[model samples]
Target chain A: DAGVTQSPTHLIKTRGQQVTLRCSPKSGHDTVSWYQQALGQGPQFIFQYYEEEERQRGNFPDRFSGHQFPNYSSELNVNALLLGDSALYLCASNPTAFTYEQYFGPGTRLTVT
Target chain B: EDQVTQSPEALRLQEGESSSLNCSYTVSGLRGLFWYRQDPGKGPEFLFTLYSAGEEKEKERLKATLTKKESFLHITAPKPEDSATYLCAVRGTGGFKTIFGAGTRLFVKA
Candidate 1:
């Protein structure tokens, strides 16, 4: 079965610009979660979506938002990006909202200049 | 405050050398501990999960053990293929989010 897949493996954006990253969850999975990983740091949870609605969120600011479609695909959008926003954006999926294991995608590296 | 800390920011060993990575955590309520392996510029791959104290899980040459306060990933007879950053995370009591550690970078030289 195909695992979680993300689009535009790598991207470069300018400061003050907005960017949107896409993620397709693993087959048979329904819950999708977003995370941001800075260099040398572990991924910090951004938000989680289930049943096309956001169910949980992390400590990130309001500039970070996401949407999950009926097909269980997700999109992560960051507005007014700062250089600090440059990092690896990851997407994870689980079969259930309360599942113990989360399968992660390869992630998209966002570089802000 | 909830926090997860991993020891040994980086480690280098010979092909046959073995070592252990530590993950220390303190959360409001402990639900589970998770381990992941990540390569350069890639997302993490799940390794193992420990639900309770004194529990252990193994996959190939990698063995993971857990306690109430900390968890360990022991590598046996490591190989160059084992080179990657090992990350540890814990599921929060809320059941909605997870807390992650900074991770330990391991490099196996042949």
Candidate 2:
């Protein structure tokens, strides 16, 4: 069975531009959550998507948004990217929102220039 | 606010040596504590999950034990391959969001 997968292993974007990262959750999973891992720090939650709607969010600003499709795939979009936006974007998925065990993808490294 | 803190920003252990890493958390109505191993440039790999105090889980040379406020990951006779960043996270009764710690970087030298 395939695990969670993310697209565009790496990306480079300039300030004021927007970027979208994609994620396919693990098979048999339905909930997708996004996280940002800055250099030398642990990952911070961005938001979570369940039932094709955003269910919960973290302390992130409005510029960070996400979507969950019917197929359980997810996309994280960051608008007006800043230099600080450079980080590793990780996607985690679980069978349900209440499930504690989440499987993660390889992650997409976003480099804001 | 829910928070998690891991001790010893980094650790260096010689091959065949044994050591333990710590993860301390403060949250309301604890649901579960998770342990993950992350290699350089890779996402975290789930290691173990502890739901309550006095619970313990073991895999290979690693063992994880949980208490009310803390958890410990014990590595026995570690090898170079065991070198990686160990992350601890916690979930509360509020929602699905899991708060994570800064993580402990482990370097097992051969």
lDDT against the true structure, each candidate: 0.93, 0.95
The digit string of per-residue lDDT tens for model 2 on A1-113 reads: 99999998999999999999999999989999999999889999999999999999999999999888999999999999999999999999998877888899999999999
Task: For residues B7-86, write the lDDT of model 1, one tens digit per residue.
Answer: 99999999989899999999788778999999998889999989999999999989999988999999999999999999
User: Which residue segments of model 2 deviate by more than 4 Å?
Assistant: none
RMSD in order of candidates: 0.9, 0.6
lDDT of 2 by residue, B1-110 (tens): 89999998999999999999999999898999999999999999999999999999999999999999999999999999999999999999988799999999999999
Which candidate number has the best lDDT? 2
Task: State the fnat of candidate 1 relative to the true structure.
Answer: 0.80
- Give me the candidate number with maximum TM-score: 2
Positional deviation of residue B1's Cα in model 2 after best superposition, in angstroms? 0.9
